[model samples]
Target: MESSSELADIKMVLAALMQGMNDTKGKAQVVEPKQEKPSAESEGVEGEEDVDIVQHETNAEEDKGDEGGLATYMKMHQDFYASLHYTRVQEMCKQKNIQYFRKDMGAWELARLDLQEYKDMLKGGKP
Candidate 1:
């Protein structure tokens, strides 16, 4: 008798929860985030990283004959490679046939590596 009464109580709670859940799912409000103008200092660093890469490559075309400049450009990219995502690092490991447990290490540590081969390995290679 007690078990049956408990079951009935459970069913009542479950029914209420099921109905309440529908309200939450369909009535959710989403607001667009306001974009902020970045400070000049930040504008030069993180904000310009992607743009720098594009600009750097184009600039390299103008200096194609400067082998030292080309090497320096590649080295500069590797120097800041720690800004890369962990999944990217994992992808590089996959491309280079390197075995690693992604969960066992961090993206920061992998990105901090000074190895240019690891950083650019996935640019046009097989995983």
Candidate 2:
């Protein structure tokens, strides 16, 4: 008898929940965002399909022959220089007049110093 009463209470609670859900259905408010007007430039002149215009600027020095090639060559062979022995790297730095303190730097440091000095030279900095 008590179990039947508990089952009836459970059914009543479920029915109330279902009725609440049904009442709220199809009554939800949806908000749409307002769109902004396009500017005259963005709309473009009549008869032209809307297209984005971009401007590209090239570096003057990058077009020069030997100087441009130097940057490219160093970039291409960075790994080769880094792989050389400390003594060889130091010798190359000396030959190229790349300023680096060999007493405190290892092979990798020496290689990077050489590359950086070359880059600076290309930029018209100290040789």
Best by TM-score: 2
TM-score of each: 0.23, 0.25
Q: Tell me how far the alpha carbon of residue 68 in candidate 2 is from the true structure, in angstroms, after superposition.
A: 6.9
- Ten residues in a row with the worst lDDT in model 1? 103-112
The runs of at least 3 residues in candidate 1 whose Cα sits more than 4 Å from the true structure, single-residue gaps closed, are 1-67, 99-127
Best by lDDT: 2
Per residue, candidate 1 scores C-alpha lDDT tens digits across 13-125 of: 99999887756656679989999998887877873444443543356655776543545554565544435665776776666555656623434333334335544654547
In candidate 2, list every pair of residues with a backbone clash.
Answer: none
Candidate 2 CA-lDDT value = 0.67
Instruction: State how far residue 62 of model 2 sits from its true place (Å).
Output: 2.8
Per-residue accuracy of model 2 over 80-114 as CA lDDT, tens digit each: 76566667767877776666565234444544666
